[model samples]
Target: MIKMALMALRKLAEVILAAFTFGIVVAIISSAPAEPTDPAIWSFEDTFLFVFVYSPIFFLFIGIPASIFIEGIMKKINLRNCVYTHLVHFILYVSAGSLLGTMVALFFIAEGFEVYIVVWSTIAALCFYVALIGLNKIIQFSKEHDEE
Candidate 1:
């Protein structure tokens, strides 16, 4: 029961973090000075719309399915090894993050936004992966120390 609760809490944390990061990115983009006569550039309304449209699609279509698949694979392996489990989780997280980021960038490009989609999306993915990895390591280390 405790483990299940903890899992729920962790998932909640991940969602919150993703939303926060997305908000920060939107804020940064929105705060930039507008280029006169650049219709491709995003206005504040455009940024908000992008976020509003993309967030649910990302969570529902990409994030949830990827997470479920990864979890299923991990469970099937039944490996009682933290290192292997962490590695698999890290790789899966990176893959999902990258895929989602790329999709968002492509969507923006398709909508006629003049942003540097590849560079920004890659950076976003990397940052998210790094954050997740760091969080995982900290949790693992804490659990190990507690066991000791």
Candidate 2:
């Protein structure tokens, strides 16, 4: 029971970290100058503050449940090969990122923010996937080193 709880906690930590990283990347990307009239109007401080405040709630309500569902599916499939495991995880991360992006875009739209939904969503998803990939690599490296 304790082990299971620890595993769940670890997963939550991973998702939260990934979500915050995604938020940061989105804020930076969105703050870029788009046109002569709209020259990077978003304030970094404000964006970070907003994201920091809301991303955990969003992740807890949406991202974590979705990831747990995907993990359950993977376990049900009895996938043991490392390659298959990595592939499944990649798909999970990308899908989660896309879902998160869509939700964020919808929120921004509802709030009367003047932003391109598709662009921001895609950027957020890509940034999230990349961050997860980096995290995965680091974890793998550490595991390998520890086994030596």
Return the top candidate by lDDT. Answer: 2
Q: What does candidate 1's lDDT look like per residue over 1-148, in tens digits?
A: 9998987667555544554566567657665466646767777656756774565445445555666676788789877888987787777666666665666666756666434654454444444445455567778899999999
Question: Cα RMSD to native, each candidate?
Answer: 6.3, 5.1
TM-score on alpha carbons, each prediction: 0.47, 0.60
Q: Candidate 1 regions off by >4 Å? A: 34-62, 71-128, 144-148
lDDT of 2 by residue, 9-84 (tens): 7666666676678678767855644333654466666676677677667556765676677667778888889898
So what's the TM-score on candidate 2?
0.60
Model 1, poorest ten-residue lDDT window?
122-131
